[model samples]
Target: MKDLIKESISDLKKSDGFVYVTAEGEKIDLHEAAAKGIAVTPVNPKSEVIKKLEAAGLDLTDSKFLNDLNELISLLSGSGSTKGKSGKRRTFSDSEKSKIVEEWKKVEAAGKKTKAAFAREIGVGYQTFINWLRD
Candidate 1:
């Protein structure tokens, strides 16, 4: 089972995600790296531990579950409310915003109605198109 845990950790790291680990004593910490998100689930922490994780609410499904959770946590961490450390909201400069608007106008001249529609016509997501417009 130790090998299985290690293999799972390897897989998670490769996928830029995390896994549970109890190898180093009883300590469990959420480790995040640019390569991936990782959660070391302590070995034999207790059956109730799993229940607690579930009760606290988590997907726990296979695939990118660990990655998704870690990513969400990281995102929240930057948003300030996660730890009561507020940060400035993102804002685009006028020139950049103007560029986006100009590009949108050009696309509009070619007969685009909405950002999503324009994005579809140009092979991108609606949000991407909006971002381009707001450059």
Candidate 2:
């Protein structure tokens, strides 16, 4: 039975849509079936996944079930407590900063009040530009 369940799950993962039939012959949509599958898992999930599951008809009143479903979804999505963080913070050289500041000055002299547009022109956030001005 476990093997059959695993096989069904694998099939569901591979297919874009799956139709599930209940004992009483009620047809469940792909989203609802996915939600039911998620609900039976042993881990807690993220809020987004929980929202989707709730939309698919899972009762959020059962906290244990909701938590498990969320965890399962997070694991399946390759995220959550198990995933490692990556990527380094971007840094600008002094010369690069000077060049950006000069461009910002030119924009200011042109009487442009759109800080966002000036920031985009120099490839930085408006807040970052404001911080650069302070520096």
lDDT of the candidates, in the order given: 0.52, 0.60
In terms of lDDT, which candidate is strongest? 2
What is the per-residue lDDT of model 2 for residues 30-126, given as tens digits with 9 covering 90 to 100? 4666777733222212333345445666767798787777768866774443223233445789898888888778878999757776775444667
Q: How many collisions per candidate?
A: 11, 6
TM-score of each: 0.26, 0.34
Clashes counted in candidate 1 amount to: 11
lDDT of 1: 0.52
TM-score between candidate 1 and the true structure: 0.26
lDDT of 2 at 50: 45
lDDT of 1 by residue, 40-131 (tens): 45344333344445555644554478766665776666521233323444455678657667877987788747677555443445676676
**Model 1 Cα displacement at 83 (Å)?**
23
Candidate 2: C-alpha lDDT: 0.60
Q: Name the weakest run of 10 consecutive residues (lDDT summed) in model 1.
A: 79-88
